[model samples]
Target chain A: MIKQISKPPLAIDDSAVDATLVKRVQGGDVRALGDLYARYSVMVQKAVVRTMPRISDADREDLVHDVFLSLLKLVNKFDRARVFRPWLYGVAIKKTQNFRRKRSVRALLLRQRATNSEDNPVHPPADGQLENAEIMEKGLSSLPAGQKDVLILHAVEGFKGEEIAEILEIEINTVWSRLHRARKTMLQLLENEREEPGGHENGV
Target chain B: MVCKYLYKYLDGRLDWEDRRLFEDHLAHCPACLQQTSDWQQILTVAASLDNKDVGARVAPPSSLDVQRFETMARKRIEHLGRLSFLGRPLAVAIAAAVLLGIAIGVWKNEAPDTPHVAAPAAVSSRVAPHKSDTSGAPSQSLSEAPLVSPSATDVHFDTKVKELTGSETLHASAHNGQCAHMGPDTLCLFPKSRAEVMVSDKAHVVALQSGSAVFYVQPNETREFRVTTPLGTVVVVGTRFSVTVTPEHMLQVVVKKGTVRVEGDNEAAMVQKGAVARIVSEKSGIVTRLATWDELAAFSVLSKMIEEVPAKPLHLKSAKKPVVHDAHQLQDTAQAQSLKMLDTWRKEMIAGDVDGAIEGLLRYLQAHPNDVDARFLLATCHKRKGHPKEALALYQQLAQHQTLSVANRAAYLAGDVCIKQLSNPQCALQYFTPFLDHSGRDAPQRGEALYYKAEALLQLGQKKEATQILESVVHTFGRTGIGQRARNRLREIQP
Candidate 1:
């Protein structure tokens, strides 16, 4: 597990230190690279965790490493005239999204094979008691990626619809609509489950 | 319309005017309120499902990881260095020509005034001088080679301490723009410039702060000589090479004799004779190309060798380890006067003062509201005091920062509190799923994370996935404590 320390967010006004460090790193200073790592490793890790919430620790570490490597490689491409945070955030989000996309494909293929295999059943007896979480997972798994992302980001991550809209590159109304649909779908699934022969509401 | 309002109202996505209208409508409608209540119940349960698959967030890679990366980066940089040379196909062919002696043969046949057609002439010129035997076969041609002048003086340096490994070796001084005769067979020549360098005799290493230095290592010697720059390290067994740290702190290694290894970050490269390797940054762009003769001209002048000054024997012993004390007790008073840091809370908790620890953390949080670690500690103390709801809320808040080192643990704890302490297994499912998802195969808590996820699945009547995860835990982690519990649970569920 990565050891994380809490520090205040980097002041938006403090681009000077970042500039000097960037210059040093561009100049091929390995120690300066280490300094940059110390400064932003946490921020990058947080971005990975928040964006790809289900990613493992080791994978997260590798992602963080890749982020720094990308930063170093593309440091020249970065517009030093602008703020570093937004650019870094964009890179982090893109990398995480790519990771999720690739993983999703792999998982989908695995799930498809399982469904195709007659020997491998889809699930055990439906008579097994349904926990609220299990029912929700099933509901969530059934939702589309866009809806699932919005639901998790808004409901679980506590991001505002507007904030999520910008983060996910969708409209604010889209975020709202997705959140609403996600919730509606979850409720519908739960309601349907309750109507079943042996099903109970599993009230909170 | 009722579903729309209830869903939007629960999500807090309703417009202000709509919200007011909904409130007015709900005030008179008991049925609407009940519907809202049921939806809220589902929403609350759905919320827990988000964190169910997450594992505790760890801190960034440790210092050890950083060091390992550095070593790996060094090797990669060296490899990239050679790869850069390969990028220029012309340079590669020219290097091949030099090795086959075709370049030297062509050069020997050409008139002295003939314009050098290739960069190999200048590169080959440097190595030719050092290979001369006692009769000076190669040095005989030094006059004909425009780059080499036999008038330069031999530099000298005092031999410093030597160490085998796992220790530091000290050098006497650096010769700014001057060459030094390192030993009987080793000759180190520095370009006319300003730099600080430390040469270690036993380890055969040179630490350069700035400027460039060329080394002529006799081929017969079996020992390796290494040059350490601010950017990377260059290691050579026996070679004629020059290392320069440019103004941009870029490390460039030019090989004139045998191959030299250049390492930066996680990468390494080997620079063949007449080839130059440069690391522009820690990034992937490593340049290795054939060096033009003009670029090799800087190393031609050998400085006046300064007389050797014997270094006084300075014995260095390892420093004794410091005594350990309670970090909170000693650090809190020293670092902060008013604030009770996490150490203090830890000390209180370890002393079995759960109330005191909770109070201290609360007081600390009062001043440092952004302190998630303190919040996490407070939640742990709350759990110890058997206040599951309070702890769950705090854990949720801490878990919001997915990157937090304790976030995964907080998520797991939240699930545990909800399922075991609060009897909300549905909520536990949310936290447990995320915990299982993010938990690495090597994580000590993986068994528990898997078990909890299974338990949540079983509770939700999802027996297949639950059974699979439970069986996995039992089989994979059979020797562990949680694995035993998983086996027992599996039997209970299947029977």
Candidate 2:
């Protein structure tokens, strides 16, 4: 029997094109692989930027590389039966999370050494010279990864709750709850920012 | 309670029933509307931030980085190509043992009869098998008959070769065949029941017109070579393998060392060492099995002596040119340059520089118009660059070369482009029909091909025929993705 239908079936735009490209890549068609990379590298970059807001250019590039490398090696294992974008999103998320974990371990080591590193452990505090974009990035960074993922995918990336849930491998109801809580937390943070000394009005 | 519908409505994910209920509630609700308005502002901010991150902040990997990665990947792929034989080490060891055993057996019995004389370049004449006539050879005739005339297309061999003619009147009469010596390698012909073979002077390729032969390719041969038969093609870099066509029209390949890829009909399979691949008549399918007597003669002393000598390590010529060359270094240089050009084209294509690759390929094709491989590459570039009309034109040209290795896949891709990109399903049918007709029943994309044809038929207002095709797909490929797609289409039509 068909499982419960998600609110929006994850339909990637130009999915047939993606399928053809995938088949060609499987056949070792280098041009098709290059086209696949050209088409989706931007999406992968966006995912890293949002999911990992404060990452360095090098780290971000590394994460992007890892995502594509994983795609290249493991593409044969991908179920062509399913949509490609959701699977790709899953890879991006997992790679970013792995990077985050590695960074945390290094941060812990630095802390033990009492190293005065400029970069924060995870999410750095908003400094005095924060612009609107930086402040917004800081706000998204403050939320838990799950909530950040839901909010960005839903409100930012324009994916539906069901599609987000599929990418995150969660329930639609869970996606809604995460979204609601994320918004609540965002409002509270903005309110707190407004009341801070020398702080400007909340950007949002 | 209204919050659920509110979230869905804001996200634009609310179903009809939930949307109607939410609207009815919104008509009477003030507090919810104010809350939604506040939420809308936050959402807009979030959307803007995402847009800014993508448009201004997030940066894709630099082209330099991509080129580095592509370079590394290309090296890795090339390494993998060279190491393909390593995947079946045990098979190789076992095949080597069995082959050695057969060789030793033949040598023990036949050693005393033949003289230990090195072969001459032109041994076309057959002498009676007697030790008194010319030293100690008993089974094979010594060279005495006049040399057979060389073909017009024959290359300038370092040494002359004797062509053979079997007696048409003698049934199963023994016609002793001499091994053709080319550099360090040897080509032995063991034709059974009216087999004809052609040996190339360069020793890089052989054509079997109507029989079986054993090729003991020297390991020093760096470039991959091919043995073409009427029924199949066996490609290998360096290996000991035999290609034979059975009376039943099955093309059989037995790999005794390294690995060989057999391409015939609509399929191709890699026959590793000790493995036998039988291409059924008409290239319907390939059947792989363990090596048996059919692969090589049970007793052949000459075959045994070949394995007794260790293979020389291949010394590749240069980094720029990897092909191993003989004394005819000029020919090798030209071939190597062509290969290097193809590699450059591949790298360009993979870097998303289709325009550059297309220009290069077009120019290259002008000089080599009969190079179907270049045209195929060009067709793929067009397909990837969203030029369906150009891709179709090239594919149509390629489809005509039925003997080309990638013709089936090229035809299928052409049809796929037609149905998916061009919206010319009627045109797709022309290619799809031929592809389906040629493809075996168990071909992987048969179901998808059928579904595509069915969709085209439906688009042409042939619903009844389309439905029937869908039913066939659902019944035949019931659990596959194509089957599921067909089922979904059937549901839409039936409902």
Candidate 3:
């Protein structure tokens, strides 16, 4: 007879070093807060770049700096026991979202101006060094925000679904479902491109 | 049972009982067996897509940018320091003036018979209970204290006291001070004298204070090491190998060359070429073992490549060759009948008639109660129809038998069903624990048993316990998909 399978166990424990550093920062040690920022800035930057590629390099650095400064303001309210990586990523995700929205507005305005003009029409910036990056940016922008967030956090950032849930304040199952859907959609999009003549030439 | 546990089986999330039931069903039910093959194909497709590069790229931060950012950070800290000292006094002055104005108002409003207006003492006492008890009293005195002890006098006394205690504490802790930070592909080593160990969600700190010690760190992993000996603090990256310390407070190191470096006492050495170094207490060290490859590879964390070794080839002996019999005469009647039953059930299942399939299998089992095939097929049908509880009961029955091959399969299926379908990790544990308990050396399912057991542990929130099980699987199975999965899960949990 086919035997009934059982589910695996789940474990939870507070990370001690994370807890200590977070506690110190919350306790008003600016140096501890700075140390925390220095530690996670690269990871946060990578996650942001994956999501917000269109942002200028200078602007990306500024965004990263602003995230730390914003985090500094809220350090006193952050929970010491909770893992800080996901929380910081969540903040970075929000910052990236804000940056995208501002860019979108600017693009919309530019399009409107081009449409109103009789002779001059605004063209998109040449692909240049960011051609592949632009395609990825466009693909990500096309995804639903929730799905995009889950995909970036899980696939690109190498976080587990459970960690993504903690960062996004969602259920673990939600993370899984979003990841599944996002992967399916990305596959479908890639397949569509593959069917087009010369699409493979673009090195996706 | 097979149907019920299919999802769990596919996800590799099944507990023991369900996994057993699913396997039992698969052994007997050809239709469910085919379904598993289809599921495997789907997984292959999914994995391929996941591995495909989608053009998300990253360029490393330029060295120039790092320099500029560090300079800016230093300036910001200096500016904040100046602001903090100057801002605090102005804040206190404003607070004092507000308090004085309030006190004047209260004195002016006091009636002839009013009970002394309590001289702000009763008001302060009443407010103390409402505010934070720790900081409330000190803040209340901010206005009163500055009037008695001017800011300059208090600042001088505070500085003197701080200098006396800070210098002593600094010297005591300075010996073992080491700080290390790890990013995705970079390990940053700071001076041991100024380093303080702090571990966050993305980083780890290990204090290695002995004169010599060996540490084996695995790749895609980061560990902060603090060394207090004369040669300085050494930070290493990647896994596999050990470090040994000498009695003279020098570090003798050997690395299989993932990445290793010694930083301290105004000197740094990058130990490449799988070399060994004898770092003297005060002098720059010499690196040896450069002629031949370092022996540290053996000590390195075994890679996932180890698990890929195929099962040992089945041995065939000539001495006990089977006597040939006529095909019709040799076929066991019971076995033939069971085969016919499986055929009919498979046809019914293929026709999309699950009830017919289940009924046929159940009758076959009723006639031959010990017919393992029929029993397993029935359980699988029930499982596919979403009857996990029933599948569990059936798989549990077969898993207890002395038949090693059949029992092991049943146990694995049972674990799968419990984990995937019902999402009951606890129930899954019941089935998986036994399989692990009984698996012997060289059993094909032994590695699988440990892996599933760990999965069950993980689902149940017993992470540390699960980590031990996963570690065992990695040690045993090495390069197999199961071992790779275990390693991946370990990374997820460790940091």
Q: Per-prediction RMSD in angstroms?
A: 23.8, 24.6, 28.5
Highest lDDT among the candidates is held by which one?
2
Candidates in order, TM-scores: namely 0.29, 0.32, 0.36
The top-ranked prediction according to TM-score is 3
lDDT tens digits by residue: candidate 3, B453-489: 7777877789989999889888888875456656766
Error of 1 at B86 (Å): 22
Chain A TM-score compared with the true chain A, each model in order: 0.51, 0.63, 0.58
Task: Write the residue-wise lDDT of candidate 1 on B1-495 in tens digits.
Answer: 444476667677775446656754553343355356446545444454433333135464444555566555445545556334223212111010111000000011111222211222112211111111211332234224321222333434435422223222222233423434344223333332222333333334444432234443322212334555544566543344565544242556666544555666655565666678877665644578876433343333321121122222323232422112223322332223222246456546644578977866675567568866578668767876779999999978866775634566677778878877887778898887776676555654566667777777787789999899989998998965457667767777776
Listed in order, the DockQ scores are 0.09, 0.08, 0.05
Pitting candidate 1 against candidate 2, the one with the higher lDDT is 2
Off by over 4 Å in 2: A1-12, A49-54, A100-145, A184-204, B1-4, B15-37, B48-56, B61-72, B79-495
The TM-score obtained by model 2 is 0.32
lDDT, model 3: 0.46
Residue B57, model 1, lDDT: 52
Clashes of each: 55, 5, 91
The models' CA-based lDDT, in order, is 0.52, 0.54, 0.46
Off by over 4 Å in 3: A1-15, A27-39, A102-148, A166-173, A182-204, B1-211, B214-226, B234-495
